[model samples]
Target: MKSTSTLLAPEEEFPTALSELPVLEIHVLHSRVCRQLDHEYLTDPAGAHPVTLDRHHELVAELDDRDAA
Candidate 1:
């Protein structure tokens, strides 16, 4: 009879595909900031401009989620 130990050998854990994901672009981040600024300017020509770190974080989170999926 074949030994059960051979059948129970653990499989190797290969590197995740996400390890190959490319880094985010600085230019793209700048462009997104510029677009947000433009929209703010259009909406309120005299209002104090709000810098959106949250927007950047959301963008990064979305990219990471895509990579994981």
Candidate 2:
């Protein structure tokens, strides 16, 4: 698998909390969490909460809009 570092350019600004870690480490963490979320959803699609996902999507959209500005 290509490292997460390959997905993002070097000049990209990471979240402040992750600034101290190597970009590869941050990517690994993101990949692991996404995999875990996917597994959880697969095991119990209805059991998983929707509100948090909705909020996440909203936030992402807002961020995208900001970036596009």
Candidate 3:
């Protein structure tokens, strides 16, 4: 097997907030959370934890707010 990393290059500064990230990065994060929620639903449909859902909502709201501005 081989190993890979997603770490940024040393000269690349990581964004401190979602608002600071590029559009593609934001989409990737949203996609990741959606996938997580899907898995959580599969394992426990009735009582999935609220944290993931909250994050999803937050991302959506941020995008909406950005679009509105």
Candidate 4:
């Protein structure tokens, strides 16, 4: 049998320093629940944890906060 890895096309990279992140649009670190179940079943189980929809927002908050400090 052969394996197939073509699900989504490759994404373009935007290289930027950490200090240039944006402000947050939402608050609270999620409910800290069931987040893993959907990922475990829906995505590549062996692959690294998939980034959530709001990951960029969260990262922006983190980076922007560090810059402010």
Task: Find the candidate with the highest lDDT and give its number.
Answer: 3
User: Using alpha carbons, what is the TM-score of model 3?
Assistant: 0.66
Q: How high is the lDDT of residue 46 in model 4?
A: 71
Q: Which runs in model 2 stand beyond 4 Å of their true positions?
A: 1-16, 46-69
- For each of the candidates, the C-alpha root-mean-square deviation to the true structure, in angstroms, is 20.1, 9.5, 7.8, 10.7
TM-scores of the candidates are 0.35, 0.41, 0.66, 0.28
Over 4 Å off, model 1: 1-24, 52-69
* Per-residue lDDT over 11-69 for candidate 1, one digit per residue giving the tens place of the 0 to 100 score: 31212332343444433443454465555557776732433444444445656676698
Candidate topping TM-score: 3
Instruction: Put down candidate 4 lDDT per residue, 1-69, tens digits, no spaces.
Output: 111321211132222343443333122222121243244447765743444433444545665576688
Q: After superposition, how far is residue 46 of candidate 2 from its true place, in Å?
A: 4.3
**CA lDDT of every candidate:** 0.43, 0.46, 0.62, 0.36
Q: Please, what are the lDDT tens digits per residue for candidate 3 over residues 1-69?
A: 111323222233323477877777777666666776777678885844577777678778778878899
Looking at model 4, residue 52 earns an lDDT score of 41
What's the best-to-worst order under lDDT?
3, 2, 1, 4
